[model samples]
Each structure stands twice: as C-alpha cells, then as structure tokens.
Target: MRPLTAQDPDQLGRYRLLAQIGRGGMGQVLLGQGPDGRLVAVKQIHRQFTGNPEFQARFRREVLASQQVTGAYTAGVVDHDAESATPWLASEYIAGPALQDMIAEYGKLTVSGLKLLATGLAMALLEIHRTGLVHRDLKPSNVLLTNDGPRVIDFGIARALEDDLALTQTGTVLGSPAYMSPEQAECRPLTAASDVFAVGAILAMAATGASPFEAASTPQVLYNVLYTAADTSAVPPPLRPIVEACLAKDPAARPTPEQLLDLAGRIEAEPVWPVRIRRHIADCHAEAMAWADGTARSATPQAPAPPKKRWQRLVPIAAGVSVLTLVAIAITGIGQEGTAVAMDDPPLALTDDETRGLDVCALMKPDVLGELGTAVGELVPGGVTGCRVYYLDQSGQKIYFGLETSIPVGETRSGNQPMGTTINWMPVLGRYREALSCDRSVVTQSGLPLALTMTATPNAGNGCPAAERALAAVVRRLAVNPPLRADAPDSVLRMDACTLIDIAATSAVVGDPVRERTPHGCAATGRDGYFAVDIDDRVRPDNVVGGKVRPTTTIAGREVYVHHEAETYCEFIVMIRPTRDDRAEQVHTTYYSTLPDPPDTCDTAAGLLAPALAKLPTS
Candidate 1:
C-alpha cells in the first residue's frame, strides 16, 4: 500500500486512513484502521462524482446489498455512509495481492491452487446471487489471494438483478472485455450466467498466465468474447472439462454457480498454495497485521504535509506581514506553471557505470506499460532495489523482465555457476529469487552491489538467448543517448488514461467506459465505436506505424502527427514531453477505431484529447 497523500483525510468516519491501497474511476481505496483497531478497506468516492444522484443512489444500494453477503469467499462490508459528503464504504481487509499480481509472479497456479480458487469464487457467486445481486465486475484483479483462501472483492459495479441502473447508454458495454460473456460483450441483458462465463475465463487466465480473449485492443477482446470460444487448451487435464463447461457460449448451456461448486469437489491438492506463494502470503499477512498495530506497512512513506498553511501559524504575523506572505504564495503558485519538472531533465537519463557492472535491463528500451502502471509493475526497493518489466512476446504470451540491484546482507559470495548457459559470461544469480529462466547476476568481488536479473518467465521462451537479445537492444538505445538515472516520476500525461481523461466530460464524445485499458493506455467503447488515448515512447524518432513519420501540426508547441485513414480510423499522435533531439519520452494520443467506415471517429477521439491535453501542466 502507498502512504496516504497530503490530500487524503487522516480519518474517514470511524476509521483512520493509514494508506491508499487502490484507486478507481470513482473513488479511492484506503487501508484504514477501524475504531477497534481492526484492518478494513475504506472506499471513498471523489467529491466530484457525488453530484450525480444516480451514482449516489446506485452506490448506496450496492453497499446495502453487500452487507447481506457474509461468507468466507467474500470480503464482507462492515460499515458505510452514503449520505455523507463523499460516499464511502468500509469492508474486511484481506491480506493478499490481487490475482493479476499472483499470475505475474508465479506464472500459473498449481493444479491444486486453481481448484481452490475456482471453488471459492463459485461459492462467492452463489452468495452474491442469493443476495439478489450480480457482480458485474469479476475479473482477475477483483480476486484476492489471502493465506486462508481466495476472496472475491470490489462490488462497485454490482447491481440488483432487476435494476438495470441505466448506467450505460443503449450500445455501451460494462465490465472487463476479456472476461465478459458473449451477451455482456454485445451489450445484451445480463444474468447470473454472464458471471459464470467470466469465472471460466478467470480460470483459463490463472492456468495459462493470460486471458484467452486478450487482444491488441478493446474491440479485439470484445470481438473474441462475442465470436470465439475461450482457449482453455493449456488448462490442466483434470480441470479442463469443467472450465470448458463454464465457458459455453449459450448462457443456458453453461453450468450454474451451484454446478461449479459440485465440479470443484472432484479436484484435490493439499497445501492449496505452492511453497513460494504461501511464503508471499505469510509476508503479506504479517505486514497487514503489523499495519493494523499502527506501524504502517513498507511501501508507505508518511503522509505529506498539506499544501495549505495552518491558520494558527499565521496568527503571530502582523497585518503587513500577512499581506506579503499572501503575495509570496501567489507568486510561488504562478512559478509552478511553466516548469518541466524533474522528468524533463535531459541529463537524468539512464546512464551505465561499466565499473559497477552492466545494468542489463537498462540496456534496452522496455515495453510500454498498459492498464498496469509504469512500463514495469511493482518497483521493489531496499535489499534489492529493482523493478519488473512486462511485455507481450511475439507469440502474444506475456514475458517478464526483472532486474534488481542486489546488496546481499550477509555473505560475500564468490563465482557463480552456469544454469542455462544463456549468460555464460555473467554468472547465474540462481533464478532471480523467483522462478525465472536466463537468470544472470554479474557479480565479481569488485562488483558487490550486484544487479541480479531475469529476462523471461520459466518455459516461456528460448530463456537466456531471449534475455541476450533484449539486453542487446537496450545497449543499442544507450549507444544513441545515455540516461542519467532510473527514478520514474509522477507526470500527469504518464498517469493511467482513465484518470487522465474526464469520463464525465467525455461520455458525450464516447460511450460509457468498457474498461478498455493497458498498463499504459486507456480506451472507451460504445455501440457506435471506440475512442482511446495512449502514451507511448516508442512513437518517438521514426517509430510511426507505417514508417511514414512526419510532423503535421504543433499542439501547445509540441509536435503532432494525425494518422487518419479514409473512413475507418483516426489518431492524433502528440509529442507531449520531449526528451532528446526530435524525440519525446512521452507521446500522448486520441485514437478512434482500428477498423474502417466511421466518419465521426476523429471528432470523438480528438474531442477527448483536446480537453485532456488542456489539463496538462505544460510549461
């Protein structure tokens, strides 16, 4: 959990907000301490969203419905205050990482783990359905892997089975595209069966380490959901048939949540979680318990001081002194207007210190992060300060690129032995402390601050050879322009696209959000079509799709290239933050359609871009 920011309230209702665990379109999720010192997750809506009566009513209803769902499989609601200035709800805090994180770390769960996960989810659904609600959003990220068992969470999109809520206009969709059933994908009426299809998709993802319906864009995922069958080929033989049954296209053909529970009874595996996973869970639980004791968890730095000054501190000043102080404040605020901030520092690029041994991952430009934050996900610090790089390989399978600057606490180890012969010169670091292939840590006696690394997950590729190729590319990029440092900054343009774009404002231009996003980009789709805003560094220098890279306009002094093809697609390529000669580290865009025949694409795409870019604090 990240520490609460200065803007965060110290206490919400009876809970003390310790840290911000997550954030979404409507509100923030904080790890809070209840009055009795119990850990709870407090979800508070943003002040702006509270103006919508429909939104307020829907949230109030959902919170009320959630309280009725009490079970081991679900995170039960403990308290809520919808009538407050900012509607908020507090629920049981399960100490675990999201399923997406688990898959990213452990590849796929063991056969034993999968069954346990499915059983818990099925039971959770049965509970939710019994409460007369449908969990509209039930993707991998919605599931948490606690030490005891899996828990379904985030009923924010839930609705009473009978109340449609009119959340979306006629053609717009809801829920995650990759996990949506055929009916949900097509914006048809939903039933309990839609959720069953999603559970099957989740199982396939947990087994194969990716979504069966995942694609390059939102439309693709939706299209796959509507027309193609979920690819459960990689699922374990024992559970494959059960998963297939759940994924059946026809809602009526699929097994009910009760039937799923019966199927889960057949599979068996002791110690439900693998050793590595169990160890991680233990660490998570300990941290959570410690945090409940008032010592906030690791990722938390103390909350920053408020931007506003304390009134008491000004009381001692004279009338004239107070006036001067106000003037100073005004001037300081204006000064922040035209500054580029730290990220724009040209010299602060990633520069290698050969004497300290090569930082291999830094050698190549990594893949652009999508729906997830950063080109990498978790940036772990301390003993081994490093980050994890993720990318879809050529074959579309997700690949990992992990690098850690290791400072071993105890032993001053000697030469390392060969594991896969991929990094023969660089000694094997023993599989990256996690199971990974091509694990290389170049540590000589002189190189005490070791950079332990891994390029791909086990069994995902040519192992060491693939790592070598990725490393070589990094070197090539460095040869062109060396960087100064590796610390990522918080840039408005670099933030998640959903947060960047004003959904309330853009709803007129595009339809409701279908939650179309990548770690680095965001897209919203409706029946008419789709509009997307993406930020990519790859677009710099001649990385344009057709190699027809040419500047067409200057947007707020930054260059832009409008890639418009006849009637089907429109995208405004903008260089938001320039880094080097004619190249930018940040390229923001508004894209409409990958297909053809829509004339209003540019109007909608550019419509959102105009407002979004206007909000950028550019110098």
Candidate 2:
C-alpha cells in the first residue's frame, strides 16, 4: 500500500482512509477505517466519469444490486452514496492474494484446494443469480481468495436482472476475453450459464497454468473459443467433468451453481489451504490489525478486512454452516496486451547466453545440494555451448550434472529415458543406474532450450526424488530468465563468464590455447611457457594487477591498468562496464604470464577484448 499522497483525502464520508488498496479502470480502492472500529475497502469513482449521468446511474445500480447480494463467498456491501459529487462504495474488506499471483508463485493448488475454489465460486454465482444480477466482469481479478474461502468481489460492472438499462455501448464487448464463454464472446445475451462456463475456465486455469482459450492475442483467443474445443489435457482427471460441463458451448447443457454445490459435497473450511497460503491468510489478518493500529501509516503493505455492526461482532469469525474456502484471487484483465511476433517478421536478435542457454552450474546451489549430503564442486563453463556442475558427496563420491542448451525437437535426445511426467509443460527425462546414480534431463522453454542430465555416484533412493524436485524447481526459476553468471546482464542477472572471455586472444599469447574451462574464466596453456587470459575480471589490486600496478594506455587507445611492462610477470586489464557492486563495476579482460621473457601479457588480453568491444554500436 502506498502512502496517501497530497491529492488524497484523509476522510471519505465517515470512513477514514488508511492506505491505497488498489486502483482499477473504474476507480480507486482505499483501505479505510469505519466509525465503529471496522476496516473497510472504499472504492471511489474516477474523476472523468464523475459528472456523467450514465456513470452515476451505473454506480447507483451497482449500489442497489450489491446491497441485495448476501452470500458467504462475497464482499457484502457496507455503505454507498451514488448521488455524491465523487461516487463511492464501501464493502467489508476482503484481503487476500490475487489468485493469479498465488498460482504463479506456488504451483497449481492441490485437488482439495481446487475443489474448494470451484465450490465456493459456484455458491457465490448462485447468490448473484438468485439476486437477479449477472456478473459480466467475472475474471480471476474479481475473485478474492480469502481465508474464509473465495469471496467474489467487484460488482462495478454487474448488470441488474430486473432492469433493461443498458450501460454498455453496442458492439463494445465486455468481460475478460480469455475467460469469456462462447455466448459472451459473440456478444449474445448472457445468463447464469455463461458464468458457469467462466467457473469452468477458472478451474481449468487453476489446474493448469494455461487457460482453455489461451493465445497470443484477444482476437485469436476469441476465435479459438468460437471454433476450437478447449485443450483440457492439462487439467487433472477428477476435475475434468466440471471443466467440460462448464466449458460446454451450449449454456443450457451447463450445471447450475446448486448442482456444483452438490458435487462439492459437504466440505468444511478448517485451514485446508497449503502452508504458504495459510501463512498468507495469517499475514492478511496481521496487515488488517496493523492498519487498525496505524502501522500502515508508513509505506508498508496492508490487507483487506470487514467490519459489521457491534451486534455482528458477537458471532465467530468463521462459524456456523460450512465455511467453504477455495478459489484463488487473480488480478488481471480480459487478455494480456502484447504484440505477437508474425511468422514473416525478421528473426528477433538473441543474447549470446540465450543462443546457448544451458548453464548447469547456474542451477547448482551448494546449500540445496547439502540437503542430499552433497556439496557443489567444480564448474565446467561451456559458454553458450552448454556446461556441467560437479558435486561431491559426504563420502567423496563424484556426481555430475551435465546441462546442454539446444533447439526444440520433436523428441528427447537419444539415450535419455523420459521420466514419464512433465512439470510446467516441460518433459523431464530420467535415467537411473540401479542404486548408483540417477541421470535426468529437462526440456525447458523454446528460446531457452535445455537438457539437464544429473547423475550421482553410489546414489540412494533419495537421489531420484531430490534430483526430480530440484530439477523442477530449477526449471521453474530458470524457465523465463536464469542467471548464468555472477555479473549483471542484459536480461538475467548473470551471464556465462566463458561467453564474456576472449579465447582467441589468450591462444595468440601461448601459441594455441588448450581451452580448459573454469567457473568465471578458463585455464589455458601457452607455447613458450604458461600464459593465462582470464576474461572474468574481478577488479582487485592483487587479482588484476601482476608485478607492479600502474595506470597505462592500451594499443587501441583504451584506458587500462598495467602491471610489469618489461618482463617476468605482466598483467593488463581493459575496462568494460561500471557497476555499483564492484564485482562487475569494471568490466575488464586481464592477461597474466610467468614467461620470464618478452611479449607483454597485458597487450595480449587487450587485443582480444578490443575486437568484441569495437563491434558493439553502444559500446
């Protein structure tokens, strides 16, 4: 929650504003305290729409419609004033993480969690339908995944059942495009069945990361919803019936909210949510208390809550009947906005690391390896070509995690057996050597193609599970942008030090380079004696400077730090990018030698870095 700006009013009517909850297309949501020590979510209409009679009418209708809504899985209206200069509505605050964020952070909910979400949402729809209201703007964002269960909020765009008042303009389609049912997408009359279709879509999304009509654009999504059947393969088996029925193009064929409750059965809410979500629920309460105690006065995150009359306070927080809890609160709109790359468009330029994206060493965390009685060992940096992570067990057994980045193919590479399962849509390959070791491969995303093979010597049963779990976590973390180096990067925080090194220049000094890879740089062999061109420039006096340190100029007019210009041992560093962390502050390539003869080592490294730097237009 952001601190109240000068433009913000301290009090809206009788409610005292605390912090900003959120602001949507319609208006701003402020976390406010009521006169009776009750915390409330106050939503004010945007200034642009303040004077419009049509807007006022809709706001009034919303107030009336919301007042009539009384359901367990809903944010009951506390108060409202549509006739005011700046219209506003207050509801019992329902604070919880949006469903989209929750699912994105933690994988899809367990079966129990999904079922709870489905059932609670169904019941909420039942209430809305009973009250002669059609929630035209039902999407993940509107659904608040609260501790008591999923409470369907946001009736700002809800259409009243009894009235023919048309607030929406003709041909201007409303509702979330991805979650829209066939009827809604076609701009046809909507009914409770349409909402049932949305519930199915929501459940499907909860089961799988993607939605039924998920596509690059809204037009494509709409076309798919109209023409193609939902790809329900990703959803778990048990929930297929609900998903299929709700997703049915024929609204009449769909099940009503009552039918869903029957399917949901007699489930009770007793903190059945996962441990992390449970913690969120506690945190939500803590934030609400914090808001009440004036803790949110500063710039700190706060949560939502509800306050009833003193008489209602006597009732337990979650009591009587089945306090159904399920469904996640997702905060997003109809369709994601972004231009889709056309087939004929020029090929998008890729970073060097993305070209050869596999960094097996990047995935290796010593702390995590320690859990399996293993510690991270040497790293075989393969630049963009691919790399390997070595590990040592407590018994000194060697373990290798070989990783290679490549293009997407129809099948897994030869020799690696499939794990018979996929996580986050990527195939997991597994190869076990009795009890000795387990080798695994991960088929990552398209651009960042990766094949991971992990094997542990003298492996026990723990290795397989550990490898699988760790692999899955790594894929999730690295699927988008994984750090491949310690320095800051174009996208991911890190890049391969090998990719940043100059092998050709090092080879020039010592005849032909042996090309031995290391974590940051490489160890190379020269012709006459021994020469090292370490491109991994960790700017330090002793590390970068060879004999005697002094500022010097390069052959190509680049500023550099020179050491031992004459003979014996010589070193030179060519600068690159400046960083605050100092680890990458000075991007320099250093060349060190113990030749005890001629040929300056600093000049050798400088020659290699010059060509690469010269090619960069920005550099």
Work out the TM-score per prediction.
0.50, 0.48
Please report, in order, the local distance difference test score of every candidate based on alpha carbons.
Answer: 0.58, 0.57
lDDT tens digits, residues 1-619, model 2? 5566555679988999887765433356777889898888877765645776755765776778778887998878888777777778888876576665566557677777877788789889988999888876565656667766787876655676543233222433345556667766666556778788888887887788556776543356667876788988878777777788888999999989898777655434332467797687677777777777876566444365333322112110121111111111111122332222110011122234543333446556553243334546576644333455666655665566555443222234565665555544345576552344565565433333334445443434446655565565455334323444443445222333345445665566666766443323334566644443343323443243445555676545555566445454455554445433343323334455656565655456566556644432232
lDDT of model 2 at position 10: 94
lDDT of 1 by residue, 1-619 (tens): 5666656899988998787675433456777888788888887876756777766776776687678778788888888888999878888877777776667666799988988888888999999899888876677767888767788876655666776435323333346556767766555667899899889998988888878876633345556877787778799997898889988989999999999988887886652877788788777777766666656544455576333222111111111000000000000001112111010000111212431223333432332122211243443321113445666554556666665443331221343443432221223344333344665443322212333343555345345545544543332232223233442364433355566666765665445656454334566766545666655433354465565665465554545566653366666766555554444545456555543455566555656666676665562
